[model samples]
Target: MTLARLAELHGVATAYEPSEGVTVQVPDATVVAVLGALDVDATTPEAVAAALGAARRATEDRLLPPTLVRWRDDGPVRPPEDLPPGTRLRVTTEEGEVVEGLDWQPLPLGVHRVEALAPDGRAGGSTLIVAPARVPRPERRVFGLLAQLYSVLSSRSWGMGDLGDLRELASWAGRTHGAGFVQVNPLHAAVPGAPTDPSPYRPSSRRFPDPVHLRIEDIPEYGFLAPEYRDARDAVLADAAELRERVLRKGALIDRDAVWDVKRRALELLQTVELGPGRRAEYRDFLAERGRALEDHATYCALAERHGHHWRSWPEELRDPRSATAVVRADDELTARVDFHCRLAWLTDRQLAAAAEAAREAGMAVGIVHDLAVGVHPDGSDAWARQDAFAAGMSVGAPPDAFNARGQDWGLPPWRPDALAASGYAPYRGLLRELLRHAGALRIDHVMGLFRLWWVPEGREPTEGTYVRYDSEAMLAVLALEAHRASALVIGEDLGTVEPGVRERLARRGVLGTSVLWFERDWSGTGRPLAPEEWRTDCVATATTHDLPSTAARLSGDHVALRHRLGLLTGDLGRERALDAAEVGDWLTYLERLGLLPEGPGDEEAEVRAVHRFLLRTPAAMVGVWLPDAVGDRRPQNLPGTWDQYPNWRLPVAGPEGQPMSLEELAASPRLHRLLSVFGSLAEHRAEPGTGAGAGSAAGSRTAPPDARPV
Candidate 1:
């Protein structure tokens, strides 16, 4: 009982409801393990009593919570009324201004420091977050393209899609298809070395992007390569062409390692090029702006090059980024490598900004919606640098649910809620600021994590994990403040078994929710498809996501066969097939009933169009067209349960017959054009003014000036 109380005191769950009428207590061992991760020991009865008493005494003696949030729109800061009498307060604004009275009138929109001095001479300080009422929203109703950028390779790219491809895709989609935005998977830097983890969700560091996505030709120095470099450059160009052909023509899987090998060699050559005076200045400015965060990441890459990507295996002193800084500067070789990595970061940043600029110039109402992965790989750059910010010996995962009866361990380290709050959420604020810099909107993957996360001990199954809650008010406040500064929309991937009220809370903060057509059913009632009018206005309505089967696969019942082929089906194949078929049939039937689809039996292609047409009919603020769905791709980019069983995150966008298609081919694809025609041709489906509805015909809506900012 003491252990349970201690766990509860630290926001660790003792029990949870997997379903409405069911409850299961977390294993006592799991509770103790989880508490241990939070630096509380409850191994034995004596320890539990001591820990619980210590926790109680600390709480009773504390002057304030670790963090407090003040929305400026709510008026002024309201100090905790429960503070002991004669507890004096002090406020220090982010701009370095001090306020003695604590009135905080005309509150600043930044993270501030609040100090409290008790009558008994006890003093404490807490992070005070001052933020906007909410993030920005698109003023106009619009529809956009959703794609996995790597899967959509252009002819000019080395092999996989690059920032150059992103720029071109955004420009063409905005100008030709009236796309208001193009959302893609995370471009965060990957764990370095060959045979890298393919999933974008498990990034090495969310701070920097992988340089493998750079377009060598876009670098100004590429055109000015000296004659001596021509031979090496030509070799890389030939290899790139071969790599691209291997995927697009030869039907080979997207070899990320091979692509990086080719890109890295070419980048090494590009690094040696002499920067002109103006260009040198630009580079210097970027370095100055990025400061220590950029330096720390570069240092990791430099060390990784010599010691390998896994930081733990390195020399003991090098494990901590702070200490490693001294070790790096002492060695000339490491310093040079760090500088090389820094250059790559600068180039990647430049190209990303270029992509955003392209979208803006193409009249996109919302340029690019960048995806933010939920957490970082446990052994990656972030974990090494921001060591104190994360929970040690614990991973972020899911409890047992319908998706996976065994639950899911993502192998990503979660931030320590205590550390984040103690640091004034500066780390969280910095991350959001970096992501939103060039984004028209930011998509937070697993957005529910802002509230709470399931923490599984290092050696435990995901099922053994218990939930640990965070200061959600502080989390959302930091997000709101950053998004407001960027004038960017916030979209939370509030999918899966969301805890009750999570979606509502996200919506209240002007954060858009993701609503897939297949899942928008009345689960509690008829289990029937939700009507268009019944869909919520605050969502990015779409037919599919990267994790789910493509529209063609779902309609043709091919996903079930694929799952069975891969040995991923836990149940009888026949029953699974029947259930899947019935589910698709229900959605198709609903589409017909809603008059979104033509009567009678439709072909697979027509069915795909009908599904998206249903999305447009909803009063959703934004509608997303899965890029592959526009074509006839039938494979999922990621198959959740099986890692090696399926070529997850390695397949290019292919045709109905599974032939990898190039960006040029997709642009000219008759099937894709036919599907998009629905978006541009629907007359009666036009959203009424002031409805916040979208999917306006692209035919006449392309009149916005090139300079028009994203709505």
Candidate 2:
């Protein structure tokens, strides 16, 4: 009983409601391990009793909670009931300005400090979080392009797509195809080593953008490299050309390590060049703004280059960022390496800004919609540097459901909810701020994590995990404040196993939810395709996602064959193929009935256009056209269940015949032009004033059978 009480106090669940009204008790061993991560002991009955007593006593003794959150729109904060009658309170803003007394004016939205003084000379301190009431929402409906950055190779790229390619893609899509935004996969820094994981969803640091995406020639200093380095630069360039040719001509997989090897060497030479006075001052400003987080990340990168990538393997003193021994170990050579990494971050940030600028210049309203990965790699800089912020020895994973009975362990550590609250969610705030720096809108992957997360104990299967709750109100308030400050829209990927009212709550807060076309159905009624009018107004409507089959693959029944070939299908291959074909036939039949599909059975490109045209018939605030779908690519950028069985995230954008297509080739394709003409014709509906309510045409309002399940 005491153990359960301790777990409850810490927001650790003793049992979870996997489905509404269904509760499953968490195992005792799991509870003990979870509590232990919180620095609480529950290993034995005696320990449980002692810990519970300590927890109760700690709450009673506190003059204030570790953190206090109040919306700026709300009236001035009231003093805590636990404060002594005559106790005085003083608040300090992040800018160092201080205010005294409980009659505090609505504070600015940020992390502030609060100090309490009692008549008896007692004192206490806490963090105060001020947030906006709600985030900003789009004023009108818009459509955009969705793409995976690395796969969209251009003629000027160094084997893999870089920021230069992003800029060009955005500018062309916005100017020529009338796209309002270009959503890209997460560009978060990956763990540095050979044979790096190709998936961007799992990254080393969410706070820092990966320098591997940097456009080598964009740095002004690149042009000034000494004539002595010309031969070496030429050789690197030749190698890059060969790599690019292999991907574009020979259909070779993208080699991230090879791309980074060339970029890293070139950056090393560029780092030797001195910055002008103005640029130096700007760099200093960036350093000052980033502060400790930037310094620690740069130091970790330097240390990783010296030792290996993982910080746990580093010497004891070096594990802690602020340790005196670690500082001493950062010699001149190490210091130079640190500076190089920092410069890379600044350069990447600059190019990202340039891409955003290019999009806006080419008439894109939202520009780039950057993705935020759910968590950081456990062995990466964030987990090592901010040790206290995460739960030790626990991995974030999905709960067992109808989709995957075995569940999934992502190998990313869950944040310690208590720690985040105590720090006024400083780390989360910092991450959002950095991501929004160059984004017009930000898409949060697994936004459900803001409420609760399934935590698997170290060495345990994902099924042996329990849901841990977070302070969602506080989390949303911080997100709203951040988005409001940045003038950026927020999109939550609220799909699969979402709790009831979660969608409603996010909508109320003005955070748009994702509405994939395949998943938007009237489940309350017949299990058929949802009428276009029934689709929600606040969402990003898309035909497919990176994890699912491409539009062409779905239409042609190619995904089934691919999965079967990779041995990923659970049922008989023949049965799977028949079911897949029927699903495609159903969608095609409905598209034909609506006058969207002009051609019959085997015309894949025309069917693809019809699918997107159906999306246009919906009232969703934003419609996302998968860049691959535009050119009839038949491969998914990622296949979730397989690792090496298929090239996930490494495949270049391809044609209908499975041939790689360069950006130049795509831009010149008449088929792409014809398909986009459909979107261009529907531009009027997108340009309709105000929210997308009643903005859709009535021509496609007839309901189809609700086959809302995603493949």
Candidate 3:
């Protein structure tokens, strides 16, 4: 009882329901570990009781929560309960400007500090967040192309796709097909290691773009290099060319480390070329803007180069990012490396800006829609720099359900609720601001995390974890404020098992939800395909995602076979195939009835076209077409639940025949152009089903082969 009370005060769950009526009590041990992560002492009953008492006392004494929200459009700003009348209020705005008033008043949309003083001289202060009532929404309905940037390689790319490819792809798509935006995977920085984790969802730093994604030749210094560095730079370029050939032609996987190695060498050479006056000024401004955060990140990188990626494994004195000893230990060599990394971050930022600019120049309404991963890698720069914010020795994951009986652990560190509130969600706000730096819309991966997250204790199975509630109001307020400030839209990836009322809250805030075509069924009732009109209007509708199979594979029932080959299927292969085929068949039949699938069921390309047509019929504000689906790509960029056994994130976007393609080839492909033509008349909000050129012209891949076992 005492323990439960303590847990409740800390926003830790004592129990949870995986489904409607099945409640599972969390283990006492797991609760203790989580409490410890939040810096709460819950090891014994006596400690818990004391903690509970302290919490009650704190609650009774506090004038406000660690943070407060003042929605600008709300009627009257209410004061915290029991605040004596005649209390004076003073607000320190985000810009450090102070505003005093007899009582709280309507303030600008920004984070501010609030102070209170009563007649008795008692003083109280709390962080006050003044934000808009809702986030920005798209001005006009739009259709966009979705691609994993790394997989969308071009002839000029060095093994994997880079920002240059993003620029060219966005320009062509927006100008040629009237694409409003181009969505890509997270370009967050990877933790340096012998073999870096390829999963972008678990990156070292979400605040900075990965330097590996930089197009080497695009660096201004590369073109202006001194003669002495030319030989070395050319050698790296040659190596990069060879590496590119190996992947695009020789059927090798995309080697991220190898690509980074070459890029690093090239960067080293570019660093030697002195900057011109204007360029130097830009660099200086970047340094000043990034300030301490950039310095800490660079210091981590430099230290990691010598002591390895894990900060804990480094010398004891250097474990803390701001340790005095660590500062003293920094030598000329280390300082030089730190500056080098800082330069790389600036260059990546510049290129990201350029890509966004190109999209705008091509008339895209919403340019580059960036992805925001749920959490950061435990051993990365983010964890090292802001150790105070993250819950140590705990991982964020999902509870067990139909998908995986044993549950799953994502291995990413979650932000501690206590710390987040204490810091007024500064870390969260800053992360959003940096990501929105060059984004038109930010897609939050697993956005339910704003409300609560399942926290699995270290060395425990994911099944034993319990949910930890976050102040969703504060979370959403911070998110809305950031998005509003940037004049960007917010799209929440609200897929998988979601709690009731979650979607409603997100909608109320004007945050768009993600609606995948296959999963938007009326499961609680008829379990039939949800009608186009019945679909949610506030969402980014799509046929598939990177974690899921490509539309080609989904329609052709090839994804099941691929999963079977990798032993990812829990049920009989035959059973799985039937289930997949039936789902595909249901949708195909539904499309035909709606006049969306004029070519009927059997033709694969026609079926894929039908899916998009069905999507367009829905009232969703945005529709995204998987770039791989444009051409007849049968391979998934990523396959969850399998790591090394399957080359999850390494495969290049391939054709239906499983051959690699350059972005140039994809752009020129008639199939791609034909599919995009469906939206040629989208501005009119009515694209005739079979009016797109080349519909039913060819049957490249059948949704279900004739030779397949009968469904």
Candidate 4:
């Protein structure tokens, strides 16, 4: 009971419902570990009792929480119960303006500093966050392509897709297919090393984009290099052509490390070419804008290059990013290396801006919709630079569910709730600001994390985990403010075992939710496929996601076979195949019955188009077409629960015949045109007012407006 009380005070869930009627009590050991992460000691009964007592005392004595959140929609400020009458308060707005007294008026939309003075002469302060009531929503129904950027290789790319390919994809899709956006995997910087983790979900830092995604020749320096360097640059380009051919012509996997090796060499030579005055000034401005965070990240990268990737293995004094000893250790040579990294960051940022600009120039209503990973790698830049912000020795994971009986640990460190509040969520706010700088929309992976997260202690199975609550009000307020400033839409990945009221709250905040077609059944009443009208309107509806099997793979029963071959199936292969086949048949039959499918079964391509036609039937404001689905790719970009057995994230985008297809081939493919025609038909309806056949018609043709004004 004492332990439960302590847990409650820390917002740790001592018990949770794994299923409808099953309540699983978190073990006492897990509770202790979770409390330890929060800097609360509760090892034994006596310790728990003492902790509870201390918590109660602290609450009684404090006049304000470390952080306070008030929504603009909530009206005015109400004084806390503990505040005595006539207590003086001074509020400092984010803009350096100050407000006096405890008036019942609304504060501006920003983080304010509030200092209170009690009648007894006691003084304390707190961070007050005032956020916009809701994020901006899409004005019209928009359709876009969702893709894994690295897999969408172009003929000019060096094995893996780069930002240059991204730019071309956006321009082509926007102009040719009338795509409103091009949504891709998180471009967040990966931890530096050979054979880097291919999954974009677990990044070293969410604040910076990865340099590996940079297109080497796209750099201004490359174009204006000295005549002497031309031969050397051409030689590198020749090697790159071979790498590109190896993936597209041959059956080789995308070698990211090999591609980066060549690009790095080219970059080293280009770095020697001094920048023009205007370009130099622009680079300086970028450095000033990024400030210390950029410096720390660049320093860490240089250090990683020098002393392996892991920071823990480095010398003791160099562990802290700001240590004077570390500064001394970083001699002139290391300083030059750090400057090189900073330059690379500046170049990458410029290219990303150019891509977004090109998308809008091509008439895209929503340009590049960037993805935000849920957490950072445990040993990466974010974890090292902001050590105080993350929960040390703890990992983020999911609880035990129907998918994996043992649950799953992602090996990513979660933010420490207490630390985040104390710092007024500076780290999180800064990250969101940078990401939204060039994004038309931001998709937050695992949006439930704002409310709470399932944290597993280090060295423990995922089952030995408990939920740790966060200040969702403050978190959402910050998110809303950032998106409002950017005039960008926000989508939350609200799938999986969501707690009650979470979806309702998110919808109220105007942050869009995610809706996958296969998962939108009427589980409450009939367990039948949800009719198009029954789908949620406030979501980005799609047939599949990156983690799931593609439409063709699901329809053709190849997914089950692939899983079986990789030993990822927990059940018998025959039974799994039967279940999979039945599910696909059910959907196909339903589509055929609804007149969406002309023919089904063996015509997998036709079935794929029907599945998308079904998506168009939904009233969702936004629709996402998986790019690979249009090409009839049978492989999942990423196969969850398998590592080396499957070349997850390595397979190039392929055609129905399992042959790798370049960007040019995909654009010209007859099959892609057929799939895109379905969207075009819906787009036609959306272009007309009062047609009522398209989701946009009901909204009075939000998308039929003139082409977006280019920035």
TM-score to native of every candidate shown = 0.95, 0.94, 0.95, 0.95
Candidate 3, residue 399: Cα displacement in angstroms equals 0.2
On a 0 to 100 scale, what is the lDDT of residue 320 in model 3? 90
lDDT of 4 by residue, 277-383 (tens): 99999999999999999989998898899887789888887789998236734598888888998998999999999888877776677778999999999879888
- What is the total number of backbone clashes in candidate 4? 0
Which pairs in model 4 have colliding backbones? none
User: Which pairs of residues collide in candidate 3?
Assistant: none
Per-residue lDDT of 48-165 in model 3, one digit per residue for the tens? Answer: 8888888888876776678998776675665566777777878888888888874556467788888888777777788888778888877767889999999988989999999999
Instruction: Tell how far residue 687 is off in model 4, in angstroms.
Output: 9.9
- Candidate 3 global lDDT: 0.84
What is the alpha-carbon lDDT for the whole of candidate 1? 0.84
Tell me the number of clashing residue pairs for each predicted model.
1, 6, 0, 0
C-alpha positional error of residue 210 in candidate 3 after TM-score superposition, expressed in Å: 0.5
The lDDT of each candidate is 0.84, 0.82, 0.84, 0.84
Better of 2 and 3 by lDDT: 3
Model 4 misplaced regions, further than 4 Å: 77-82, 104-106, 324-330, 681-711
lDDT of 1 at 666: 91
lDDT of 2 at 542: 92
